[model samples]
Target: MKKMRERTRLIIQLAFAALTNGYVSGFLGQKLYKGKLKQFCLPGLNCYSCPGALGSCPIGALQAVAGDRSFSFSFYVMGCLVMLGALIGRLVCGFLCPFGLVQDLMYKIPVPKVLRKIPGDRYLRFLKYIILVLMVLVLPDRVTNIIGQGDPWFCKWICPSGTLLGGVPQVLSTPALQASLGFLFSWKMGILILVLALSSVNYRPFCKYLCPLGAIYGLCNPVSLYHLEVDKEKCTRCGACSRACGMGVDVPKAPNSPECIRCGKCASVCPHDALQFRFVHRKKEKHGQAENIEN
Candidate 1:
């Protein structure tokens, strides 16, 4: 069952990568056969300016609205985030996000060193919130007067993913754009290099400490219907689950911890089969079956 779940996760991840990078990013280059289904933008860090993107990115959209002097909807971006939080929660970080896949692939490259400890200072995790405010909200608004409205501040200045997928490609493909390179291009390239270097040693430095989208999704994990559950009656409490958890979550104790990305690593490593990933009634049924067997 564990192996099966791993295989399924691998398939999903591969499909996500293909869709985001291969299909969506490369869609325009192909024949204009059909358009994408209409949906409110997802609350993630995907680049809206990327050629293949079918929908607007939340960060890009947020910056655009925040920078705009004329109109800004309080509900659009927040509502989209709330909806996604209520649905899949932090599963987006583990399964669906293309950037998460990039980080995962980077960690697999047999690097010299990798982050083993989860860090003693829990307060450091709050840095993402500060970044969300400064980069996404405050900085954009402050710079709007100087830089002009409709600028995607985060995308243009800081996002490594945007630099990788949109800026670099667009510049390389269009010689005219390359000629327009200035200090902004150099700064973005520097940010991308820093992120790339950090990703080699850190498990998911971006998701853990930088992604505002992950911060939002993580807040809902404790209450989401789709969450991890631990059967305490069956649990041996050997701490294997916690040790195995890559996201620094105490999985057996706090199965639906906000820090959990729902990568299934804890459930996959549990020796007693005490940890499970079932909905409410499914958990009840399993517990009842165990009772019946024991009786």
Candidate 2:
């Protein structure tokens, strides 16, 4: 039953992504409105340069601010993401992000190899923080040009999502863009290629170590309205949930750990039915109170 639910969730997520990208809307509307339906934006990290993309990407919006130096905070886009993350945590990453969904599907290619496990050092995970502070935020603004202009460092130098969905496709489709590719384009494209190749073996290297959006959303997970709980009384500590987790969360220890993407895989795999995916804002427990009060 749980497996069925998981598959259903996956299908629904994929369907939503497909429909919102204007793929379906564009195709259907072309018959009536002469390609006028290509003006919407989905809630996830979809490439604006994608032929099917109806709206701008959130990361791209952030990059525009960091890159322009003259721009202000993207209130509309940032508000949307914050509201979504606060409500769902990284459930968006696990279930909704198109790029994440693509990576998850790629890892299912059924190669005969052991799962790639990173060292379990809690500190090493801070690398994403460093990336966010330096690469995503600091570098772009610091490297200002003579005109006091900055560039979107991550989008120009790193972003695999842009490279895969925007850069590659646009370059392929438009001869003008292809002819203008410089050494930077090659460099970014190379990184994207490497990531795509590695994604087949590793689950989500982008989300784990690079994605600034993932980092931001992950911070909200520990206290987000939506969370996963393990009823310790029912849990046997069998580690089944942990073993089944794709995000490498120690389910028995901290099911709502920041590293958890709230994918529900662990909860679904729990045999004792001790795990639950529910909405709960975690609160401080009083010194001696055993009551599980909903705060």
Candidate 3:
């Protein structure tokens, strides 16, 4: 049953990845679609500049709006992110993000993996929030050139997804892009290579320490509509759930930790079936019913 559930999730992840990058014609022809769908942002981290990508990336869109001279804030991008986060939190990261899928696949490679946490791992998790605030938001919004325009710092400097899906593909396809490549492109490529190398050893180092999109969704995890519920009555304190968790969540104590991606591994591995993926408001509904009956 656990295997079945995990297989289902894997299928969903693959489907989302394929669907978001389904422009096979563009991919084959080495062209990008400048279509209406590109106006809207995807729930996960997919690069809009990718030859096959059909929709815009939320983080990229947010940065674009922030850096735009005409716009001070991106109501559309922020609203979409907030709505999705409120609905499912980091479930999007688990099931929809193409980059997350890539990282997961990288970890599956048969190698001597480093499964243990390093020193200050807990403190390092906060780095994503700092990246989100400074690179994703502040720099793009505040730092401008002589013409009052700023660059998408995160996309330009940090996003390995863009380097993998957009920059690499575009450069390979266009000889002109290769000729124009300079220090910045080389730096981004170096970062991508480093991330790929680290991902083979560590499980989702980017998600844990650098993904600004994950940081945003993580902030909503505590109050998200969908979350993991721990049944204290059935819990035996065996710590199986925690052991099964890939994201290092202490299930019994912090089942709803912002780091949890709602991957359901904890619930699937629980021998007592003490953990559940459920709507947060369902408990409120039950409480309201009990109060009405008492009245």
Candidate 4:
């Protein structure tokens, strides 16, 4: 049953990745689609400038609107983000993101994996929020060139996904693009290489530490409709769920923590059937009852 569930997830991931970048002719002919559909944003971390990409990336679109001096804010982009976050939270990272799929595949490369946490791992996870706030939002909105134009700082300076899925393909397909490549491209390539290397050893180093989109979605995990619940009455605290968790969550303590991606790995591994995926309209009545009694 577990294997079947995992296979289904892989199929879904592959299908979504293909659908998002379905312009196969673009890869063959070295062209990009500049149609009306490009105006819309994809929910995942796909690059808008990817050769085969049919829609704009949400982060890229958000940065574009934020960086535009004429526009003070982007209600449409903000609304989309909030709605998606509230609806699915970081399940998008687990099941939908093309980059997350890539990282998951990399981790399966049969290498002697580093199965231990990095030093300061807990604190380092907060870096993505910092990146989202400063690089994605603040700098882009507040700082601009002399001409009142600001760049997508995250896309330009960071975002290995863009470099991998967009820049590399474009540069490979177009001879003219090769000569125009400069230090920025080299820097982005380096970052991509580092991320790819670390992903092979660690489980989702980029998702855990650097993905701004993940950071945004993670904030909504606790209150999102799709959530994980732990049944304390059934739980034996054997720690199987924690051992199965690649994200290092304390499953019994905080089943639906902000860092949780709602991947269902904990629920799958729980022998006692303590963990479950469910919609909780409010705090569990049992927890409230316990708190009242304790008080």
Candidate 5:
């Protein structure tokens, strides 16, 4: 059953990836899709610079609005993202993101996993929120040049997704881009390589510890309409759900934990049928906390 759920999730991930990046001619021409559809935002973290991307990435769009000329806030970007997040929360990370699919595929490579859980992982999880604040929010608003145009700090300096999906392909396919490649490209490439290596050993390292988009969606998990509900009456408190969770969420105890991606592994593994994803919250009893087995 767990395998079936995983397979289904994989299919959804692929479908979303294709739907967002379906522009074949863009890749053929080695140029980004300069289309009208780029006006909109995708629910997951995709690269705006990806040659085939049909729509703007939410984080990229948000940063652009925050940092560009007017330097004003964008209700359009924020409102759209928040509304999408309210519907499914970090389910975007689990089954919709392009880079997430890459990480999932990398983790499947049999390499005798060396780092399933990072040391001090609980502290490490806080890194994404810090990136969200400093790189995404703070730096974009504060740091600017004479014209007062702030660069997209997160995309330029941090996002492995852009490096992989955009930088690599664009550089490889375009001679002008290749000639113009400098330290920034090398730096992002290093980050992408490091992330790929880590993904082979750790499941969704970027999603778990680096993605600002995940951090935003995670914040919505507690109040999202689609959320996990643990049936206290049915739960045996065996820690089965926690054991099965790839994101290290202690499911029975904190069903709507901010870190949860709603991957449904907990739902698939709950032996007593204790945990499930619900559209509406049901009655939950106060109970003993489940230890984070994977953490």
Candidate 6:
């Protein structure tokens, strides 16, 4: 079964999420983890404030530097993300992101999928890039508090992952935090509800249309060492691969498309057995016989 083929990937997702958020005592005690492990960043979009999070989110760490009073840069965070992306592209989205797992589970609910086949979805995919540049990058550095420290704009304003996994848990645990919840928390909750609702009808709506971290990984798809390859001679121009792609990637045409999450669905459904993932090493091939799909 198609689902069975993806079981390994699903298990990886669950495992990585659990590993990054393994502070059981923090959850039990209603305290966010503040150990030395929190100094390092997780490769996926796990919430930093989640009571059980043992590591900080890379996106949140980047924003902390970007929004600092000194406007310091975060080579550590950026380098970490780049290193991970270079190793496997957005495989992080497919097999590590906590929010991605949430969306995947939501999609299992029986419902009419109203958003997957919608028009102009391709255009919407670009929204994440805009958010990466504006909310994550520009606003955080440009907008500062009275003391000149900037807020983590994306975390404060738009990250549903933070709202659901971090904000909700923190508020529920700490009575004082609950009392301090204001319009910002309400806004974040609304966004979280909307994102969850959309996830039930769309595969990874947040990853496709809103995740800044995904946008960064997507860019690294072209240069990632791990990639999908196609044997052009074996291909019959059939569209089975594309059809299996929940991300709507035109596999064979663009096997390494930024939108590809490394879900491996396209490869699994290739009737010709023409598709496969490969590392940098490769045998010499005849011209035009087969190649890695271009951007």
Clashes of 1: 2
Candidate models: Cα lDDT each:
0.70, 0.72, 0.87, 0.85, 0.86, 0.87
Between prediction 5 and prediction 6, the one with superior lDDT is 6
Clashing pairs in 4: none
The digit string of per-residue lDDT tens for model 6 on 1-295 reads 4678789888888888888888999889977777798889888899888888989988898989998887566788889899999999998899989999999999989999877864778798899999998888888888888988888989999999999889888888889988898999999999999999989998888999999999999999978999988877677889999988888888888889999999898888888888878886466446644343332
1 or 6: which has the higher lDDT? 6
Candidate 4 residue-wise lDDT at 31: 83
lDDT of candidate 3 over 1-295, digit per residue (tens): 7899889989999999999899998889987888899999999889998999999999999999999888867899999999999999999999999999988888778898775464688999999999998998889989998877788999999999999989989999999889999999999999989888788888788899999999999999988988877766678889999988888988888877889988888888899987778774443345443222110
Q: How accurate is candidate 5 locally (lDDT)?
A: 0.86
Number of the top TM-score candidate: 6
- Tell me how far the alpha carbon of residue 161 in candidate 4 is from the true structure, in angstroms, after superposition: 0.5
Superposed Cα RMSD, model 3: 3.2
Clashes in predicted model 6: 0
Q: What's the residue-level lDDT of 89 in candidate 5?
A: 85
Candidate 6 Cα outliers beyond 4 Å, as residue runs: 286-295
The Cα RMSD of model 1 versus the native structure comes to 4.3
Clashes of 5: 0
Candidate 5 residue-wise lDDT, 1-295, digit = tens: 9899999999999999998999988889867789899999988889988889999998888888888878666689889878878998888888899999999999999998789899989999999999988888778878888988777899999899999888888888888878998899889989999999999998889899999999999898889989877766678889988988778887777888888888898889887877768776654335544421211
Runs of candidate 1 with Cα error greater than 4 angstroms are 1-4, 20-39, 118-121, 146-150, 281-295
Measured with C-alpha atoms, the lDDT of residue 114 in candidate 4 is 68
Q: Cα deviation of 211 in candidate 4 (Å)?
A: 0.7
Compared to the true structure, candidate 3 yields what TM-score? Answer: 0.94
Instruction: Please report, as a residue range, the 10-residue window in candidate 1 with the lowest summed lDDT.
Output: 30-39
